[model samples]
Each structure stands twice: as C-alpha cells, then as structure tokens.
Target: MKATHQPPTTGDTTPADLLRGAALYIERHGWNQGAFFQLPTRHRLAPACAMGALRIAATGTTDSIILDDVFTQVLAAQAILANHLEPDYDHTTDLEADLNFEVISDWNDDGDRTAAEVVTALRDAADTWDRLHPTGGENA
Candidate 1:
C-alpha cells in the first residue's frame, strides 16, 4: 500500500492518525536501518524506518525539520513509543528526549531490530495518544 500524504485538515487526520498510518506503512514497505526512506521514485513512496514513516505520514516529505513540529504535537505519544524501543529511556535527561529520536534511531539501527517491532511501537504510540486524549483533543 502506498502512503498518500494528505493534509491533516482534509479529513480530521489527528496526530494519532499519523502514528497509525506510519505503522501501516512500515508493515507494507518493510524496514530500512540506515536511512529514513528507500526506493524513492517519482511514482511512489516507500518509507524505510519508523521515523521515516512518521515524516511521510505527517508531511509527505523527507525534510526532517518538519519532524520537530510533528513531535511537538505528539510528545507523550512519542515517549510511549520510545519506551517500547528502549525500556530504560530516561526522558528527563536524554538529549532528544521530547522527540525520542535518539532512542528510536539507536533501536532501529540495532542489528536485532525487526520491522514488526517498529510497527508495534507505532501502534502502541497511537494507543497511548488515544488514551491521553479520549475526547480526541490535540492538547497533548
């Protein structure tokens, strides 16, 4: 399945949607360890990793700076996903804790990491987002 990056405003695509869509993307495209995306062509998108999926799901582009805005909107959700990747993650002092990018990168780059695990992390993150905002508010 190819990911179509629709603007969030068009269909009530919440932050949770971004997380879930990313998981689904990874499930379909498999995973890549060393890069954010793979097989880039003018025709389709193939997100290669967890963060890459998130970026594609959120903005449909590879410019990573956009991720800062994405993370700011879904911080706790990110934290939940990060904890799944690295159980010992200490958000308090971690250099990139709020975004959880460091832990995610380390986890994905690990030789033992699997695509299923990354997909699970994204789904769990979406679940956490739902629980935190039961009314579908974007406050978190």
Candidate 2:
C-alpha cells in the first residue's frame, strides 16, 4: 500500500522527542521482513535522522558542521543495508531523491566522529532519553 509522506511536527526538541519520532516511524513502517516494501518515504528516512539527533545530544556537539557528516553516515548505513538486501537495487535513490528528508540546521555542533562511534553514542543517548522520558508512567 502506498501513502503520502508526512514529516512529524512537535514543539518538543528534546532527544527523547526525536527518538520517539524515529521509533514511531519505524513502528508504523514495520521493521520485519517484507515491511520494507510498505515503508513510506519518511519512514525510510527516520533511522538516520533519529540517529543524528541522538548523536548530537550525546556528544553535546553543535549541529551545524556535524549534521552533514551525520547524514553521510546515515546514507552510508542505508547503502550498506540496501546492498545487503539487494546488490542490484539502487537504494540511494530513495534517500537522495526523497524531498521529505529535510536537513536540520538548527542544532549545535559536536566534534567530528565516525558513524560506528555514533552508533555507540546513539545507544547511550537512547537509554538516557528513555530514562528521562519514560512511557507508561515508568520511572526514568
């Protein structure tokens, strides 16, 4: 089933908000097998965007200079996944051509870092975000 992409909007700019948005996007899009075909444009874009926001918060980095790098890493990861899934398919088209993937410019700048390192940092940031913004009334 095809659907129009709608970027999420909210007043909250916290890392938790970003993570939640990412998770929601993934949940709505489905991460299991055969789900890829059903993903909306924004859903395909969420992992990297969410990871970028989490990395920025975790490293306390400024968003200006590092976001490009973050996006690069995200695209790289997507490429890797795409290649893994289908070597003949051009996965970059979805990420590069999608108009809904907005480049965020308002965040602070953190130092340069690798996507591998960012993955670790994103994990910590996600944990912290979850702790700080627990759902179901659970203590953070």
Candidate 3:
C-alpha cells in the first residue's frame, strides 16, 4: 500500500524551519530567482526586506539612492551573520580591508575622504547598529 505524506501545519513550523526552507529554495533557484519569490503573507517582512537589501549591496551600483536606514539594516544583518560564524570577527575591520582593494580611479574626489575612509564610516555606523541590536537566538 502507498502512503501519503502530510505537510506540517503552520502552528508546528518554527523560524529555523522557515529559514532552512528559504535557504534550500535559494540554493535550488539561485539568489536572484529566490528573491523574486512572493513572500508568505503571514511571515514577518524583515526577511524579505533584508533579501532586497542584500541584492542592492551585492550590485555595488551607485545609480539608485538607497536610504541610510535600509543600508544600516543590511550592514546589521552582515554583522550578525559574521558574529555567528566567528565571535571575534570584527565587521568594521573587515569592511576596511575590503575597501582597501576597491578601484576608485573613476570616482570623483568630493574633497571629503577616500573610499576606504567611507568604509570606515560605514563600519562605525554598523558598530552603532550592532550595539543597539545584539545578536540573539530569540530573533530566530
């Protein structure tokens, strides 16, 4: 005799289960394709928004004006993930190292600071954000 499989009810689903499902979906469909998937109505919007923010950050395009708040959230997500991987990981120092490798030959000098300096500033902002929102499993 054949047996039927039953999907877990919504009440039985945990956040980790949802995240694992999402990660699997992304792995199968690729990040861009995964981002286009319609988010479930009952789910919190933060994950969807963070996915969008990650897309923007990955593009590295300066054409669109991303708001500071959105960027901060993205950085916060990055810091949180990094912290999870390595407790001693310093996101700010990493950002500075990444910026140091950037090619800014075409970039116009605004008489303010170099690209690496900008990264340092962003790191500072991210530090402030991390302090405000410490990493916790309860969020998951």
Candidate 4:
C-alpha cells in the first residue's frame, strides 16, 4: 500500500512529517538490508532500513545511533517510533517492552517482509501520530 501523503517541505516539519518522509524516501528508492544505515548521499534518498530512516529524520545526521541517548529530539522521535511499533508500549508503564531499534529491525529484517509493507507501516504510523496529536506532531 503506497502512502498518498507527501513529505512536508515547509520549515516546520513535524515528527509525523518525518515519518512520512521516511516512507516516501523508501518508496522512491528501495529498502536496504544487512546494515544499520547508509546516508541518503549513498542510497539516493533511502536509508538502510526503517529505523535508519527514522534516525536520520530525527537527527538530520548520520552520527552513531545510541538508542539510549538522552538527547531530547531523538528521545521524542524514539517515543513516537516505539508507540507505532507497539501500541501498548509506554516507557513509564512497561520498561521491558522493546523500544525503537529492536522492534523496527525485527520487522524490517523479516525474510518475507517487502519494502511495501515497511512503507505502509511508516505511513500508518504517521497517520496514527497525526490522529493522536491533532496538532500535527509539532507539540507532540
């Protein structure tokens, strides 16, 4: 299922926009496997995998991905990503739940998983975020 929403281009791109962009990026290029990430410079516009695209969207850089980093933006992005992966996941309520990278990797690396599924997941997650936030994920 292809997402009809286009990536936000305005200066105020929100978290949901980032997710959408990730989906569009994967759609335009292709899914990457067997690596954590590759810069858009390398793979046209696509990151190596779902999580890599999210990280790039969050950090706007190819720096090392430390999933536990306390940085504000990454943490916020991770929360949104985590919530999408598992609806019941709440850091305060369920510490044992798999957070960002693990869950995304498991799904992305599944042998039968196709790029379309990954793109759909990202787009669906973004739609979920929009519905929950209602403010377009800027204040989320």
All candidates: CA RMSD (Å): 3.6, 15.5, 15.0, 5.9
- lDDT per residue as tens, model 1, 1-140: 24555445334556678778778878876677888887766765565787787666666566656655565544544555676666675552335554587777788788998888888878887786688678887533
In candidate 4, stretches whose alpha carbon ends up further than 4 angstroms from where it belongs are: 1-11, 38-47, 59-71, 91-98, 137-140
Give the local distance difference test score of model 2. Answer: 0.34
Residue 96 C-alpha lDDT in model 4:
32
Give me the runs in candidate 3 sitting further than 4 Å from their true place. Answer: 1-28, 31-53, 56-65, 92-140
Candidate 2, run of 10 with poorest lDDT: 100-109
Compared with the true structure, what per-residue lDDT tens digits does model 3 show for residues 21-130? 33333332323222322343343222222233232333222124545543443333444433433345454343633432221211212354343433333344335444
TM-score list, all predictions:
0.72, 0.27, 0.29, 0.67
| Candidate 4 TM-score to native | 0.67
Give the Cα RMSD of candidate 1.
3.6
lDDT tens digits by residue: candidate 4, 43-107: 25545577666655555544674344323444455456666777776631234334565667787
In candidate 2, stretches whose alpha carbon ends up further than 4 angstroms from where it belongs are 1-5, 11-14, 17-112, 136-140
Candidate 2, residue 83: Cα displacement in angstroms equals 35
Which number leads on lDDT?
1
Instruction: Please name the candidate that would achieve the greatest TM-score relative to the true structure.
Output: 1
lDDT against true structure, model 1:
0.67
